[model samples]
Target: MIRRRPPAPLQDAALVAVSLIDVSAHFDAGEPLRMACAVASAFSLLLRRRLPLLTFLLTLPTVLFSDAVIASLVALFTLASLSRHRTLLAVCAMAFTLSDMTSLPSPNLDLAQTATLITLGYTAATAAAPVFLGQLVQTRRDLSLRLAEISEVRDHEQLLTAQAVLAKERAQLAREMHDVVSHQVSLIAVRAGALQVGTADADAKEAAATIRRLSVQTLDELRHMVSVLRASGGRPTELTPQPSLADLQQLVSGSGIEAKLMTDLPHDLPPTLQRAVYRTVQEALTNVRKHAPGATASLHIRHEGDAVRVTVTNTAPTRPALPLPSAHHGLVGLRQRAALLGGTITSGPTPDGGYELCLELPAEGTA
Candidate 1:
């Protein structure tokens, strides 16, 4: 439960009212000096919040001659609550006691001793209670702050544990796909390639050749997915080498489509933008080979004002094609990559029985 702090002005007003009554009562009893001292001490409580130590010291001497004890008590409480140094408070307590007790005149032995004990007891009680209560309040606040920090740390640990478990399951699935499924697909491709070369009939050779090409493309995509899953953890995985714009020619060389590149791109591209450009071109050409086997394709990369633009366009297939295997999420992933870097990508059918893909990304430090 939260504790509400009392307002300072209200507390000060209450102290002043009580001290005024006490002063009036002493004045009616024919004690003019006591009345003056009481009024001064009462008004001093107004500065307790601002200057606690000074208020306490200034009001201490008035307690010996005046009946205005409320201001002195409140000052003591303010001093204890505001300051944390114990040695300074101890010195103030000693000074208050010595100043008050030394103001007395000579008297009888037994009476003096009794008065000494009572004064010492009241002074100790006045100082001890506030100091003890102040320390208690401070300790409770410290403990509450520490508990809040511990709860946040525990929640963060649980979240990390859940993510780690999910990543482990993904890695396991990727390994199974790579080791079992890819191996079978490779065997099928090998058989189909042999049949395409050795068969006598034209239709049989065409069907086998189509099967072989699709199988090889499927294997390449599957390998890429497995490598990505394996690299998801804290430690690095020795996956396939990353492709860059430097390998554009190698990528388009034997793709079985008429592909060309037009570029004025600089050699020093930021790593992330460079990788995104390479992957965009790779996936675009791969889609052309799958859906439009004999299409003429063109890739253009240009550095416009503060932006790098990439456009891929391909004409309609010139020959009958086989229905290739596809999950159709490549463009979706490419669009997401562009959006994450504050870029845009648009793709649609062109006016002349063709397809076009365009991407625009900032040339600055998007990573």
Candidate 2:
């Protein structure tokens, strides 16, 4: 809570008193009633800011009867600085000041001559000065506000630029990691395959076969990472070695949950579409683990003319759901992946209180 300093009431009182004293010195009045009226007009300066137009209206006519020129000048300044109708009020104040000066009694001069002398002399300049100063202050304030808004917009743009640069750097690092790890894992799989074929002992051959399978799975995961990183645009074809619908069996075999695979996939589907299907299933199963633990899940991949449909459904949790911190971006990432492949994805609760995720991708995929 920001506490503003209170207005200085004592200071305002002192200033009003001093202004009354200054006006009294210029007054040529001997009657107490005339002095009281002049003092009242001078003290009206206290309501200048809160009631600027009203103060000006009330004090403007008093200028003819009282020597409160200083107070009236202050009222004009306040009205010009604070009123939305400042231009009209400023014009009226100037005109009224001229009228007030002209109406003052003059013994030796004619009315026109007296009016001309006051309008052309110090009294006219004094009446115009406050309006000019008020306009100057208002202009400065408007300029300052505009500069502040421009500065805020510039700062926001700089922040967005910095975030874009950081995201690009992170994506580059991920691609580099995928390239290095996938290349090494692929090499290991090749060596393991050769060892499996050449080994004489049955146990040794089985161990080599297992190592080769795990290495291939690792390569598939790395390829998925590469696909994600390159989704922005213009990715090199050689950078991606995507997995297809063939890997769905190995994908769900070792999980604790009961899950089944059903597929009628077409041959020679585009790698991008295949990768999208694979990621959709992966993200669905991940969600099942996080949100519906001990659930039975099913993976379905079907061919429909020139497009492929993939669906994953999980039953209600057989055990109590685990308390896992979920960022819930997995489904969002799947939707983006499907969209990049010219596909659409939908997910919602099943009729039986389970969860169902569906994706449909074009066989030819999108650029």
Query: Where does candidate 1 stray beyond 4 Å?
Result: 1-145, 148-241, 364-367
* Candidate 2 similarity to native, TM-score: 0.50
lDDT of 1 by residue, 9-41 (tens): 887898878877766765635666666777888
Worst 10 residues of 1 by lDDT: 233-242
TM-score to true structure, per model: 0.47, 0.50
Query: Where is model 2 more than 4 Å wrong at Cα?
Result: 1-15, 27-29, 84-87, 102-109, 114-120, 185-367
The top-ranked prediction according to TM-score is: 2
The 0-to-1 C-alpha lDDT of every candidate, in the order given, reads: 0.72, 0.68
Count of clashes in candidate 1: 0
